[model samples]
Target: MLGPKIREIREQLGLSQKQLAGEDMTRSYISLIEKGRAVPSQRMLKIIAKRLNTPMEYFLGESTATDTDIGEAVLDKAKLYYKERNDRACIRMAHNVLTLTKDVLDQTEAYLLIMRSYNRLGEYRQALDNGEAAAFIVTRTGDRERIVQYYLEMGRAAFHSELFHAARKFYEQAYTYSSRLKYLQDEHIRALIYLGTTHLRLGNVDQGLEFYLKAEKEARMAGQPELYGEITLGLGKAYYMSEQDGHMQLSYDWTKKSVDSYKLARSESYVLALHNLAVIQLHMGQKKEALPLLGECAGIYDERNLPHKKASILEEISKIYLEERELQQAETVIKEALQLLELRDEGVLRAKLYRLLGLVFHEKDNSDEGYYFLRMSHDLLKRIHAEREADISHQILQLSKQKQKMEYDDYKSYIR
Candidate 1:
């Protein structure tokens, strides 16, 4: 069935058996394949299809392949790569599937896989683009679950990129979509979690805490410890950041529970919980207490091959050392963090790293390097988050003992 179609397209393209076979594949094998006397392996079929300028799915006799056919085979392999955190391979395979499948469902799945692979690779803009494509396909499908999932994934990508308003919009849509379904406990809880996170980022801390608490209740009722753990962590963060001092202990307790609950089940959540615990400690000026928490978070990020998380944890550790006036230790962690932030070109974190490095060098009596870094941080602050420029500018001026007037473009000549 497939051989005739392959031969038809091959001939239409004016390609002979030997031309299609290439050096590694014999012409006899190609002849056998075209004669329907032998079958091509999936790999060989892919090569043949590419050479013939047709979707392999076409020759496979499915007008469009489902998410379980040859397209699914690629998806499955991509998923395996994702599980192993081999983002490059996952991304490559996801794109391959995108080109090979015509089924709407299969295409949506491929776009989603590509989105997540880009997310893992820290390509948030590309992640959003692919997520939007997936979302567009499902817009008329009425699969509320998939709609919620699409929004949730996009919201997460935006959140990771520090696009808080965009994240909120996507998460709000996720909640709206999930709410249309009557009894999907998991979807409801997940949507609530993302919505609450967006709320927190938007500075609606009280509202975010309420959603998190509600979600936590539902999670417990549904017997989902992972969801419950995440909710508990959210609650901890809300409380820890609130103006009320009495909530600190509650935050600490809840954060610890989240860490313990997720420690064995969810590696990502476990590391996040640890980071939260460290934040709580740091907020209370207990830098020493935060060290072990940040240390564990760092180790987990490394084990998981998460450069962003690792850089963040390392930055937090450096902050603790800075608090303790441990200049050498602070410098060490800040340098390590810069390497990681630079790898992904994390502008937001890079700005903070520059400021920290600047402070460390200032304390080390290296005025020239200190001034340079602080000025860079100030410039970044002005460009990225202008609201924070006032405080950062003050730091820059204080660091400049000679008070040399460094414009925003001062560091451009040397650094860029």
Candidate 2:
């Protein structure tokens, strides 16, 4: 740690250990300082500080608990907050780290932590700013591994910000670098996955599945079953969206593999697999099985305190109930979902909620209330640029003109 502090500061300034050791000290002696095997005398320390253009506090941190130790502890706490999904607390602690040390490496780490915190908090623009700042000074001269990490961070920021093309570009750049470095296989796999997922979001399902398959193979070779399970989840999703005649069966198989794998690991991702599995079962006309899975998924979300996700499951449950002529049950669950959504007010999801409530009221033959909620949902969908949803609303509106008549085909299309 002793020599490493000096080396870190030198590296931030784009100086090699040999260059920092020249004229006064031997390179091997400097290596001993970096390796924590030796400490420099006061005079030697002063000379080294002068050459490195750093304050004596940089070296003092190596000897005392003033900065390095305390700053590292703070960073550890920030990571803990991140893991606990406390974005505000993580952001506060990461900012505290910057105040403790002006070291480029430490500051870079803090910036990145703040970036992730902002992203989790739905502050995409702020997250992207911090992400770009994390890499601005070091992209060309910093450690290759660290530079690749920043690329991944920036790619995620772009993805969350809905800049899918930029996200793909950043992931591709990172994948290119990781390809050249055999030791960066982990990052290589991650970059590939992100690139693939980005393309998937952009509706390039084949390309996305290709990358996911590659990632799965690499993860298996690397003995990382968790990573393989993750890729299988994506593969299932991609196949589900594929328009090919036989892809639905492939989707079921891949989704089953991910569900089984995650259940063995006791992982939260299994809940997502369960949701997908239930959706597939509904497609196969097995609503009897799907309802229980959706109910179980909703209970899990409730226990996790994720009201938005619970609302989603509740909405699904209501649609099935409506199709089964369970009008009162549909009204009950849709109202529950609406109340949950009111707490968080995710507008896109809320639009769907409004639509579901409208349909439930229509199914109950309450034309006035049905028309009102349907119109509300249509306005919201148009505002959100959800043209497909707006079109669906248009259909319901036209049906309202026919005295709220919902034909069999209308019922088939009512499951938003």
Candidate 3:
């Protein structure tokens, strides 16, 4: 059988099924083929033949493709997988291509693709490992453009891995290299954005702002809404995180600009920007303005079926109502938030909501219901061993007396 022959050859070459399958196929599929339980397709058979260095005729009495043709075909398939965002498949196909070619440029391209695939999969260390190999081979080709791309990909991996220092270095190299290439304006600007974010992560606020401002100029010139939104968002964060004079106001202004830009770009980050703007308004004591923004965010979260986020907004709204001494409004919002919590395992939030409900009852002079809800909050926090459980317990003890105090004392001395 073809399966027997394929297995025989594979074993002779001392290649595992994984190595034989490469990037275009799966190890399990190879196992099935070797076991004679599944037949390999003509295209797949050709790949197997090329990998095993045997002509296709040996398996199917046909020889329509050469080794070089198979190598190019595999590489093309790798590119297709990459385009489709099937990163694992792309990595396998790229690995296969490496086996069929000795050309430094082709090997470097394979390594670069592998690095990018690993990055997409959130395997940053593997991405960096492939990146090192790509960088080493790319230097021999003397291709400055590929070098720029390599650094950019490496920077992205490092950035996501929280290796800010390494990310900054790679992004700087990419920016410097892309600056020398007239056609790489987009890459140059992207490098500037990366540098800004990396510097911000490293707590270099002024340096981050400088990079962001430079990228902002390029983004405005390009008239790209999404790019402008990204830069403005970074600017907002830079201002928000700063302790400089009027920083809060500047943060609000930049954040408002970012929200507008993101809305124009139809970006999904619009809701998040709205939330940030609302928080900034609250910090500025513009509670009136913050309420409407919070309502808008709550509505969006509800429509998006993000129960936790909607409940969080409701909790904030309830807190504001409590602050205004609108007991009825606060109770209504708290009950709504509690209803949202019914299906969730969010013990912390549930406990907080119960505690708020207790406060509302206490404020209304309903001591019986107030202590009941407070005890409910305390029990939940204790069950979860939450960090604030002891504080809640102390508060409960202070608010209750006699029988209630004795019951809590027993719980504290025994259960605790």
Candidate 4:
């Protein structure tokens, strides 16, 4: 029974007797064992079981699970780890599934899980590689749904990596595949929404709006409010990019609507939308309106324990104080943002904060202290190879030679 079972599984996995024998045993030995003309020793059995991803107990009649059952069991554990948000463990389990099964669908599932886990962990390169592997396997299965899913995941990974052209290609593939399947309306909507956002990011405002409008109609018919939120966000971006005189007002209104929808869905996107709305208000010279929105975002970041996000809000608030010539308030806010930045190595934001602090000191007529902070900012920017570092270095050298205070415009070159 064991000999026949081994041969059956090996054949099912598309392994020839010679390949199954490996280097540890001869092809003739494998043939003999399969024909029951010879028995495999314990050592050989261990190697065979490992290669076939089978439990040794099964060969000894201590277990009854089929080879496919074992592969599925491993896959299920990987899924469980993914659902628990244990990304590292999920990746490990998925890799185990990859080695244990030769089934195309099972292999595709394992690759998809690994890709998603890598994406969540911010390993976009790994996620993209795994997504590609899954796409190859999914193609062999001719599973249109799986093909669409893999394309979407690949698009997301590429988008996060800022490879917008690659992302657009992947999303286009997903859109094409999903359109052919009548039951994949939800996937079709998703592909459209992502395509719209990608086009907008690539500066194709008209194309983006066209895609968003199409997705909006589909989402409404599907009764998917969550997807509708994405459409509204895309519309906000489109309106903001419009050359019309009321573009800012249109952006504000659409962004505000998106914020409300995201809030109802209890999504983290709500905070981002609110932050964008506040920025628009500032651009429109409604500082009073922007302040309260920044305050709300700061509160949310505090509750979420996201120090970097909170620091960003503080930096924005301090800018308003600086513009108003409230030097003391600006100094205090800048210092608070600096303290938060110290908790992490945010080189760009840290440099900006230092530059701002230096400006505050220069305004107070403390030239020496102001120069010290400005020097620190310049050095940090150079270390990070910031694009404006060369310009800032020249300006700093001039300030050092003349022992003169820098004007507000001098620091404006310090692009965030």
Q: What is the C-alpha lDDT profile of model 1 across 1-416, one tens digit per residue?
A: 87788788888889988898864355776877778866664556777888888887788774433544878788889889988989889888988887776554556666777787887676888998877666656553334555677788898898877777788788888887666345555877887887787776555778788888888877776666677788888988878756676998899999998988787466567778889888778867777788887878778778877787788887777876776678799899989988887666666678778877876776677778887888888787555443333354545546366544333233212221
**True-structure Cα RMSD, model 4:** 11.0
TM-scores, all candidates, are: 0.65, 0.68, 0.56, 0.64
Candidate 4: lDDT over CA atoms? 0.77
lDDT of each: 0.73, 0.76, 0.76, 0.77
Question: Candidate 1, residue 344: CA error in Å?
Answer: 4.0
If the candidates were sorted by their TM-score against the true structure, best first, what order would they fall in?
A: 2, 1, 4, 3
User: Which residue pairs clash within candidate 4?
Assistant: none
Please provide, for model 2 over 287-351, each residue's C-alpha lDDT reduced to its tens digit, 9 standing for 90 to 100.
Answer: 88888999899889888888878887887787777777887898898888878977665655677
lDDT winner between candidates 2 and 4: 4
Worst 10 residues of 2 by lDDT: 136-145
What TM-score number comes out for model 4? 0.64
